[model samples]
Target chain A: MCTMIAERASIQGSGKTENAWISIDSCDIYYDHPDHVDSEHAITLSFSNQLDPINSRISLEITPESAKEIIRKIKAALSKGDSLER
Target chain B: MKNYKTHDYEGLIAETIQFNSANGDSINAYFAKPLHKGKFPCVVLIHHLPGWDELYKEFTRKFAHHGYIAICPDLYFREGNGSPDDVAAEVRSKGGVSDEQVIEDISGAVDYISKLDISDGKIGLFGTCSGGRHAFLLGCSTDKFDAIVECWGGNVIMDESSTNEKQPVSPSSLTANFSGSLLGIFGNEDTSPNPKQVNEHERLLKAENKDFVFHRYDGAGHGFNYYDRPIYRQEQSVDSWVKIFDFLDNKLRS
Candidate 1:
């Protein structure tokens, strides 16, 4: 005897004028952000679906001022130039 | 060459030495010497891109401890306490300090060091980063330097674009002009003079048959000798210091 099962799952959320969605299958996972997503925000995702669907999606909203701070730190690290690996 | 333990002589009669450059600009420098001093060998220490700071003062103290009269000149005196970004922006916008000005300022320091009663008229030049570039420039501009040590100076083979003043400060061109042996220490990972540029510099010196020693350390990035910075490498710094002292002893002291 042989049996087959099919499952469908979807995630949706909105915070500080931003929204995102995640979809998963046994073979592939997909994530999408709405066109209205703010430029000041960053998106991060983590998942534990090794064979098929990736797990979770995360969205972080960051202001322009914070972006500048992030740039400064990156510049400092990059100042070591091509010689340093970080 | 004897190694003396480092000592701090902060707030010890650090006098400002000012003079008119050949371009009719006033140059400011700091002169530090032992309170009890006979004639001493003088050293002209040049500041890096950050200009004269506490590190320079500490260097003066180190030189003074070894019975050497030390002078550290503010290469960018016109703009005080300005950030490196400011200097870089100015250079990109209106061009920075001229090579003529650098030569004049350094020559003036050499003259001042030579004229000092505590000096034997035998002087050496030491610089880091941009100041290191100036040390090479000063050495090429004048033979007054008995010895020269440059740390992580960029592009010894000068180009019109490399120098703001459109002056050629290449080591290959200046090799024959140099009357004293030179020491150049750089980090292998330094992006300024990537491996290719360093190899070219070595080739130039070899072709010119110049008397020079070059050392490039692995795993060290640009400005690795700077203790306050995260890139500081203790092993390379200590080893380079020892080599510098040896070079100075053989070429300047003896």
Candidate 2:
């Protein structure tokens, strides 16, 4: 199925569009049909500078399991950093 | 109507053209048609969530070679045509195009195809995946089309669990509003528009005395007809393609 279930958030960063560099305004992550990925459904993420509209964006398409694993790893890393700081 | 039952498979002209869609928004479209002299029925092809790409162009030409005027309007035209993946991601983030916008876009397609010298003014629509849902939606939303081929459209049977406004209304509830016949091709294993949903939709259509044909293959799953996808089931896809032709011929040519 084409799942448009996505979460969007404002972010501070910079990404290249087509040619020039621009400040990224937001990030979106969702699970939907994959374009080049072999899987029927993949979790995809896109970072874009909405102001640019035509440039400065990046995207990734990965499997749901992989997405879950990445989330777990990110949480683990954050917890490890907190423990180290304490 | 000119008989294309046994026409030699000569080539047809295929090209990209820009036209205005809903709200007077100019969008890119792929148009294909046979070179034979006489008016021909039209098949308005709708692209899936993958966004308009080369595969749909291939489908358009395939229809043209088989003797129909086919045009696939890039639904992503509003987002600005770029790489399919990029446009798809943007669209996904934006919660996808609205149902009303889609209906109007199809109307734009009808407008474009209706004026062509080769067009017979009869048009049937075929859409895969999300496009399939749009196809079914248009059948209930508009009267410009004579037939609709919905291939494994997910979420056509959704309720108020309403993922988003993009699919605010369940097409199944509007079964009686269909202006013409519908042909649905599905895979038994597909969970989106699962077998039960297909049966339920059929039940509604039948109760309404609507013209409908549904084919559910056992071994296939969602997107079984997509040649470029991993789930492509050659046998089932071939059969469904033949069914598409038959449905179009019956609805538009008959």
Candidate 3:
């Protein structure tokens, strides 16, 4: 199915493309069909610089379980950083 | 099954052409047809949401092989040029293309094909996935098409919450207006138009007394005919193709 489900947000970061590291402007998150992944569907985190070409964007297609675990690890790491600062 | 004669000559011509779409915007399109001289039915192919990529080009040529003049317009042409996947991802992020714009582009294809001297003036619409949904919508919106082949079309029954400025109305709502013969192909395991949704779609069409036939395959999911994906089911795909050709023959050829 062509799920038109997607959400976008402006973000501040830099990501490396084949050319070089470019300033990323926005990100889109969606759970839909994968272009390369073998799975039927995957949660995709796509980072892009609006000022750059479409191909310059970076993307990660991961399973739902993988996405959840990554979120958990991210929160844990952030909590550890706060504790260390305190 | 009848086999081709040993001395039969088969030839095809395929090329990319640019034409004006909605709002007079020029866009790229692929056209394929048999080289032999004969009045042929035309098929306007609405490419799936994955964008107008290589697979659709192959599909256009396949129709040409089967003696139809086929044209597939690049709906994502206005989104800026890039690789098909890149452009598709961009369109996906932007909530897909607007239903109105797509209708105009496909209408442009119809106009282009209709003008050809070789055309028999009978046109059929074929599409899969979101394209299928569009095919259903176009068939209902106009009397131009003789047949519509909708394969695994999702969002034909869009809920109110799914409605956006792009796709504001559920196509199923126009079931009463559908006048063309329709052939729907679905996979039982698909979720978007899961069995329940497919049932509801059929119910709506039935209520309108529409002329349609639906084929549901067991053990197959969405895009079962896409050989590039792991979900491709060879047996189901072959059977569905047979059904499609048969349906088109009855609807457009007869």
Q: How many residue pairs collide in each prediction?
A: 2, 2, 0
Candidates' TM-scores?
A: 0.67, 0.90, 0.96
On DockQ, the stronger of 1 and 3 is 3
- DockQ of every predicted complex: 0.02, 0.49, 0.65
Q: List the residue pairs that clash in candidate 2.
A: A16-A56, A17-A56
Tens digit of per-residue lDDT, candidate 3, span B1-254: 12358798888999999987856888999999999988999999999988999989999999988889999999999888888877888999888999999999999889989999999999999999999999999998999999999999999998898888999999988899998999999999998789999999999999999999999999998888987767789999999989988888888888
lDDT of 3 at A76: 100
Question: Can you write out model 1's per-residue Cα lDDT over B12-48, one digit (the tens) per residue?
Answer: 3467778665566777777788666457788889877
Cα deviation at B186, candidate 2, in Å, is 0.8
Instruction: State in Å the error of residue B131, model 1.
Output: 1.4
lDDT of 3 by residue, A1-86 (tens): 57877889899999988879889988888888666677778788889989754776688988777889999999999999999999
Q: Looking at model 3 chain B, report the run of 10 residues with the lowest lDDT sum.
A: B1-10
Off by over 4 Å in 2: A14-23, B1-9, B163-165
Best by DockQ: 3
Q: Write down the lDDT of every candidate, Cα atoms only.
A: 0.63, 0.84, 0.89
lDDT of 2 by residue, B1-254 (tens): 22345565576899999877867877889999998888999999989987888888999998898789999998987786567767877777777888888887888888999899888889899999889999998999888889899999888888878745666788878888888889999999887888888889889889999888999998998888778877888999888888888888889887
Compared with the true structure, model 1 gives a TM-score of 0.67
Higher DockQ: candidate 1 or 2? 2
Candidate 3 whole-model C-alpha lDDT, 0 to 1: 0.89
Best by TM-score: 3
**Runs of candidate 3 exceeding 4 Å displacement:** B1-6
Weakest lDDT window of 10 consecutive positions for candidate 2 chain B: B1-10
Candidate 1: clashing pairs of residues: A47-A55, B40-B118
